[model samples]
Target: MVQDTRELNRTAVLTELLRIRPASRKQLAAASGISAATVTRAVEQLIAQDLVVEAAELVSVQRGRRAVLLDVVADRSLVVGVDLGASNTRVMLADMVGSPIERREIATPIEADATALADWLASVIDEIAGERRDRVESVYIGLPGAVGRDGSTISNAPNLPQLEEPGFLDSVRARSGRPVRADNDANLALLGEQHFGAARNAPTAVMVTIGAGLGAGLSIDGRILRGSHGVIGEFGQLPAGPLGTRLELMVTGPGIMRLASEAGVHLDSPADLFTPDASEPVRSLRAHFDQALLIVLTAATVSCEPEVIVLGGGIAKSLARDLARYEAMLEHHLGAAPRLTASELGDFAGATGAVVAALHEVYRGLGVDERAFGDLPVAVPASA
Candidate 1:
């Protein structure tokens, strides 16, 4: 039982470290509720495995020597983060710090070839590598559809039907020569925001992404909430509203076009709904947008009263000026409103989250490379 408890303690400490700042053994122990001696042993194992490293020396006021601070070694591994959105595909290469080193984006057709897409991704990865292609360790993709728990199968995505077929991930991995990780797009968006955006410290938050479809991502007590079958937070299925369709129709590209047409305002795409000019059609579109915002706010807040709610995706840009309107609508419905804000990461949150997950995978895969930490100091201060 003690051995099991110690192993559990190690897992807890590692999670806490990833959530917050890197620390020395003593600090990690305090933050993780683990013993310092056990933390020391864990640190040694982590360092030897190249998962952690001596970051720098912490200065001490006492006459004794300073202690070395431990941190996750980011440069030792790399991963590719891909976002397969409804209308576009974004790819980014990042290290463990979640910093992008190389990034690319391209418009995608509703129906695309999986093989061609995989080959395109492989070429993008090669271009990003330039000369040091071997440095890339793995690939991670955020699918707009529901991802199977195995991280291999894509169940269904209306906008991304090309990926519905099997062996897509296999093909990509086979072409790129690296393991692949796949996740729900909204879930990854929340991960990215949790790690690098406005909700970095929030214990509970919700990210609402509106585009071709309306989806949400939730974090409860700093942990991702993936529901049964790993497809939760799907707000698109909400009851059809005044527009004679689901609330998604109010904001999606097709919805925008449909609504605009009904309003007798001809438009090419939903993106045109946000023209800065104040023509009669534009005014009507803005008014329609306000009503749609209320519908979205009611649906999102009534279900889960999160501490913060962030709106993201292509259509979210138009709502930036109307945050107060949405907040008011939510407050009126729920009787209390979570702090509503626009997403800080814009359209790249999903890609960033994919990379973050991939980084963790690479670190876990390369266990205890003895050559990576030869003779490195691994001491920790008692106070911190």
Candidate 2:
């Protein structure tokens, strides 16, 4: 093992214990690549700060020996994650261990300007954070459109153009009274799945969403890839036909409805168009959808060869009932398919992912990279 740096010993120890707990100083040292003596000093500091606790004693590897186990105090700090969409907004409060403590939902303040909407969101954060304000670690928000690298600036958004107004992201941060970060909702969806949903532990993955509009999110080597303009996942314009048809026009909710109308039927939703007793033309909607889906899969497989491809959002959930058929479609076209699956977190995936991102951002300097928090489940405390 290398000698601990003058500044990094404590960060390393805490990061290791946060990722995996109930371990002795020896274990922390080994896992964090720090020395035992340094780990002991770091543990003492953490305990003094009430972040880590000496919970129990376990048998040591050495004969007739015992070691004190250190664990993170579950509620020592909390993070807030927000998913602001075109129609609705979801907010979650989670502890340091990524367990969601409480959640709330409401329709988006579409009538208000973007800055005003951000103010409302900040007020919601304040309400939920009430007594825990002092213990709140950070807040991360997910937007329905692309956000600038600064984490607050909105570049372009069709569904919620108001958010594109300058100072929208800054208003949330200023009024929220905590460290804040924000990004595209689709990217957050992929982040949620990689950490807590269908794409768990995958090195590379892609998530495509179908609802009010179409969007995509990508992850490569465990980091969200936003591209030069943070527009990499906007798949609405992806060429879905040989001549020149838009993917959004072929496979999204609107597209499906359009196909139904072309067949002389009015569809309340995709559910109406996909029923068993449907018209022959409406039933043929599947073929068109499959072709557009194939285009998405082919682009993903050929570009980065993702380890998994997850379909999410309202329409994707509706299509999940036929998941096997989609999986088979991938294998048939791409030779070897990235695992395709439905989102496990459902409506909360984006909010949950915001928590995950905020947690990582908190410890990024402590050696817990976004990818390092892999496969760790967000669970409720036994006392709760």
Candidate 3:
């Protein structure tokens, strides 16, 4: 019991350091609500473990002596984040403080074979890590599908069918030679927003990713909601207008292309539909998109009452110039729309969120209760 209490105090101090590093022992004690003597002992143990280091001293104005500031030795450990997309795979390495150190992107495997994908991922991990690959303590993978509750299997991934293969996660773990975790892409995107993007400090937020497909990431009180089957925000599968049962057929990039063709506007690609020189028929498709988006946003707002709804993915990113129109349409439908903003993280949102998830696992392994630390005040770099 005594050892447990001491470890708890140490974790408290360490968590505080992560939040506001380079803090004096006095500040850590005050921020953690632990007694000064306990803070001193915990700080000494952390320093001895090489997890914490003393930085420049802060001269006390009231007292003659200077106080040494403590900070986490971020370079001592690292985590890897991987985003397995329909077309590409992105891998990144980040330090314990969540700062990305390196990143790599490659074409996804052509074959829908688990072994092939694992080999490709392992190659990417090696390429990113270069010499420090072994420094990676854990790995988190974001997939564009419903991850099983155990984070070992993926289902309902039409774009990347290889993930459905049995023992896929095990194969990746064996090849990568590290602990591996997997989650739905949209869910991780929302977590990325919470930890390092626009939704920072937001208690509740929803991210609607509209691209070749449509999906959402819902968070309430800073916790992501993954349903029993790990498929909570598969909004694209929801029924909509006479077109089809899937809402993606109406609002996504491919949906826009289909709608444009039906309207007698033949475009080479869905991206062309957003060009300024788009035909009248293609321009008119915006109304359909507006209605479709309103439907999704309304459902999200009514159900979760999120503080903010973030629009992401290729289609939504292109519509940033027309945000006013989208907002007006949403207001007209819902009477009052939640705060809406475009995703600032672009395509890297899922990857960054995967890093955050890996960091959480690292914290747990170190006996740090992340919940007790509240939100950290780390400034996310404008360019990641």
Candidate 4:
């Protein structure tokens, strides 16, 4: 038990140093709320582990003890984050301090060739981490479907069925040699917003991603609200158009084109379908899209009462053009609505969030309290 307590103190101090950075034992104690003697003992253990190091010193010209500053050994601590979209796969290498070191994106392989995809992903992971590969403690992967709560199985990914194939995920894990983690891509995007983008500090937030498909990710009370069965925030099935048609049928990027095609407009791109001087058919399609979006937005508003709703993915720019108008419409119906906003991380939110989750996992292994992250909305002194 004494050893356990000592380990816990080390985790708190190390976590605080990673966050505030290059701080003295005094500062770590103050920021992390750990006792000064405990912080000192923790620092000693961390330095012995080579996870923490002393760099530079703070001192006055007068006769006084110099304060040696401590920081995480960034190069010695690394993680990988992968955003596996149906069209593109993005990977990032992040240091323990949450700074992204490198990123690479490539066309995602077709669903028929799971082995090929895993091979390419492993090579990319190898290329990005290179000499730093050994330092990577965890690898995070985000997929565009419902990931089980335990993250061992993927039950609802229609586009990338290969992901659920026997031995496919295990192949990536075996090749990478690091523990691989997975979650819904939409959930990772929401995680990105809370950590480093639009939804930062929002107590409750909802994110709607409109790409090849429509998806939602929700955060309540600063915790990712993955539902009981790992099936939550499935916003695409919301009622839209007539009583039967789902919102995803008219609100996704492909769905938008379908709407214009059904209207006989024959538009080449979704952006073209929403011009100010659009033909009547195009206008009608846009109206249908608007109504569909409003339905999803209103549902998010009423159900979660999010502090903010962040729009993301390929179609977010198109939605942002008339965000205020949509906000007004939602207010008219619901009597109140949270602020509507666009994702600040844009296309990289999922990958970035994947890395953040990986870092959190690493911290937990170091004996840091999970509640420290749960209190991210109020407790952590840094952006994290």
TM-score of each: 0.79, 0.89, 0.94, 0.92
The C-alpha RMSD of each candidate to the native structure, in angstroms, is 6.5, 3.2, 2.0, 3.0
Best-first order by lDDT = 3, 4, 2, 1
Q: Per-residue lDDT for 174-238 in model 1, tens only? A: 88777777888988887777766766667588888888777788777766777556667766766
Off by over 4 Å in 4: 33-35, 57-66, 374-384
Candidate 4 per-residue lDDT over residues 147-242, each given as its tens digit: 776666776676678777666677888888889988888888898888888998896999889888788898888888886556688878665568
Question: Tens digit of lDDT per residue, candidate 3, span 134-153?
Answer: 78898899888888788886
lDDT of each: 0.71, 0.77, 0.81, 0.81
How accurate locally is residue 59 in candidate 2, as Cα lDDT from 0 to 100? Answer: 58
Clashing pairs in 4: none
Backbone clash numbers for all candidates listed? 1, 0, 0, 0
Q: Give the per-residue Cα lDDT of candidate 4 at 247.
A: 80
Candidate with more favorable, higher TM-score: 1 or 2:
2
